[model samples]
Target: MTIKLMQGNEAIGMGAIAAGCRFYAGYPITPSTEVAEILSRELPKLGGKFIQMEDEIASMAAIIGARVGGLKSMTATSGPGFSLMQENLGYAAMAEIPCVIVNVQRLGPSTGQPTAASQGDVMQARWGTHGDHPMIALTPVTVRQSFDLTVKAFNLSEKFRTPVILLTDEIIGHMREPVKLPAFETIHPYEQVVADTPESYKAFRNEPGDVPPMAPFGRGYRYHITGLFHDEVGFPTQRLDEIDPWLERVNHKFDRHLDEIIMVESDFQEGAKTAIVTYGATARSARHALKIARQRGLKVSMLTLLTIWPFPETQVESLGDQVDRIIVPEMNLGQLALEVERMVGRRKVKRVNRANGEMVTPQMILDAIEG
Candidate 1:
């Protein structure tokens, strides 16, 4: 391993290549354009392909098309662009296409701040697409984790046959740090295995294992692909019996293997009565406050969420039982805090939110801890 000074966006580009991503489709947007820039330069050198699409909508479409052709694909964008991709993002979920989406968040409700950092898209990442489909989102607190989680995002996407979102922020995306990346050769991404012959292959089979292996477009296993409710053979069907099975299988796949899907880092002191729950760039500030609180003889624990979606309910609920109160500091107007409040209780949760594109300072978290 070699330690090199790398920015978080650069790390994500490298991670995509390492994760066997051979195709990238994206439009240029601030805070996330570097991800496309680096991929454009590097993908071709490795015999991969990268394209600058007309817009976020086309970018999302291009990547989905590429993935259907059996290439591991990805796209990156900020809030405005992410908003444009939601329609196709939902399609990927319904069709069970494996792809990664890197959202390097900036302030937004309509391009609020292009250069500033914010975690304001937390809720949007979960519910941006108008549908009831399962979603997986991962956040990174450091430059290194950005690379690692980008790789994880691709792995999870392929393994689960779902679109995985790397929900980063402008802070982590632009921040430079010494990152020791593993050798590319040492990395092996997950590849779906098709056990059935082409004559009997069912693209959306609901079998013992709900995840059906995907066969690429030209693999002799031709099956229908659609955004509507699809039967096991991939044909669109309006029948309730067909639609219900697809819904149950698609959603239950995550439920059956949540232990492997949920990722978190818990640091709890023996007698800690207060815990800080955080993710993304704000986790840095939460960690700093935890350290100082301990140094000042305060009992404080911390839970850093690496996995954002399917929310780590069991772990957070257990933490609530141990701690008197949980402090959630995010760069949004209490989006994640609402989920925490639901898992624990509104009365047991304290929220420190910022929507003005500023980092939540460690002192602000420390004050919440002391108060």
Candidate 2:
């Protein structure tokens, strides 16, 4: 294994290739276009497929189609493109289709700044789709993490039989850093849950794991899949009993597996009076602030979150019980801070947010730490 300098966007494309992703369909959008460009060049060399879709909606639909064809598939886009893909994303969710979506978030609220960074899509990644469906979002702070979390996103999607969102901002996507390419043995690829034989297979048949084994259409297991509520046999069912449990299982798979799914790195929290909670690129800034504050004899700990969704309630609750103050600095305007406030009770949480498409500096965090 050799370490080489790579952009975060290129790292995601390479990581997907290492994780056995064979298909990529996406339209170019600023800050995320590198992912599409790199994949288009690399996937063909590895005997894979890449298509420049007509639009984001078609791009999303095409990935879902590729997944059903038994290929590991993904799509990449920015804010406006992601918004266009939401309806189809909900389609993948309701149908329990496993796929990955890489959203390199740029300045938003209707395409404010295409080349600048923003974390405003944090809430959108959770609730972008029209309906109530579970989501898994992984935030990568470094180029290496951009590679690692892309693989994790695929694993989580296949294991849970749901769509997974890999959320990164423009700074992380564009910034270059050293990434060590893992050996083939180090790459843990997921086995697609394909059906065995031609007959005697059910796409929605529940096993002990609650997720049924999937079969592609050409593999001779012909089953219906639609956005409508489906029975165990994969056919539409109008009954509430069928729909309720389907939705419940969609959510339960993540909740029940939080121990493996939720990830956080905490430093010196045993007797700290203040805790700095952050994720994505801001987590890097927080680390610097924490170091400077400790030099000044301040008792401050830090929590760097790698997993953004499923909220990591238990971890945050435990950290909250011991700390008197929690500072959350993000690139968004109080998106994740709202969640921290809700989890840690009221004013115990303080928000340090900047949504002006610029990185929140270490000084901003130090100000919050001193305040």
Candidate 3:
């Protein structure tokens, strides 16, 4: 393993490369531009292709095309750019294209704050697309985890045949830390293929894993992919049967594999009366508060969610039943807190929020624990 000091954006580029990503298409956006910059410089040297699209929508569309062309593809962006990519992002999902989307989140409702850290996009990343679709999103706290999780994100996307979001913030994207890089041979990439014959191809047919292996165009798999609801053959259909199966399969891919697909970290969760819950950067502060509370002889633990979606409802509800109170600290105004309350029921979940382009510190969480 090679230990190198790297920024999170650089780490994502390197991680994608390590994951055998050969196609990158993205328009530059702040706090995330470095990912596009580094990938543009490196991909060509490694016999890969990089395209700087005219805009985020076209960039997303182009990457989907590359994926259909039998290449592992990805795109990166911040708020405004991400907003533009939403339509095609929904397209990728509807067609069940496997790719990674890195959203290095900035404060936003509409370019709310650029070059600042915010987790406000947490809900958007999960539900930003128009309809009901299952999405796999991974949140990384440290720069090293950013590298590791990006690779995992790609793997999950490919394995599930859906677009996976690497939900990160400007803090982690710009943070510098030492990451231990595994050997290229040690890293395994997701599989892809091009159909040898055009006759025997069905783009949306579900295999045992609820994902159909893709064969890129020009390799003889002359198929059409569209954003509209489609049948198993990837052709648009208004039939309820087609729509039902299509939506069911999409949800099945994640639901059947939830235990395998979702990752969560629970610290001192057993028999705790007071618990602090968090994810992303805010979890760091929650961890610190947990440590201090333990030192002061308080029965406080933390459940830091590594997998934000699929909600981890089973685990959260169990923790809630054991704990007298659960305090959720996030960078937004009770976004995750709402989910926690929904899962565990009201009257037990409290929230500590901050939304002014600032980090939630340990004292903030400690006060919640003490309260």
Q: lDDT (CA) for every model shown?
A: 0.93, 0.87, 0.85
Q: Which stretches of candidate 1 lie over 4 Å from their true place?
A: none
Q: Give candidate 3's error at residue 9 in angstroms.
A: 1.4
Better of 2 and 3 by lDDT: 2
1-371 in candidate 2: lDDT tens per residue? 79888999999998899888999999999999999999999999999999999999999999999998899899999999999999999998888788999999999889789999999999999898987888889999999899989998888888877899999989999999887877857899777655466567767764434776667668677789998878876788999987777766766666668887898888864578899989998898899998898899888989888988878788888888999989999998888888788889877998898999998999999998898
State the RMSD for candidate 2: 1.4
lDDT of 3 by residue, 245-299 (tens): 7767777677778886778888874567988878888888888888888899888
lDDT of 1 by residue, 1-371 (tens): 78899999999999999999999999999999999999999999989999999999999999999999989999999999999999999999999999999999999889788999999988899999988989999999999899889999999999999999999999999999998999888888888998989999999987644899899999799899999887888888999988887888888789988898899999999998999999999999999998999999999999999998979999999999999999999999899999999999999999998889899999999999999
Write down the TM-score of every candidate: 0.99, 0.97, 0.95
**Cα deviation in Å at residue 11, candidate 2?**
0.6
Evaluate model 1: give its lDDT. 0.93
- Highest TM-score among the candidates is held by which one? 1
Query: Model 2 misses residue 91 by how many Å?
Result: 0.8
Error of 3 at 131 (Å): 1.0
Clashing pairs in 3: 68-216
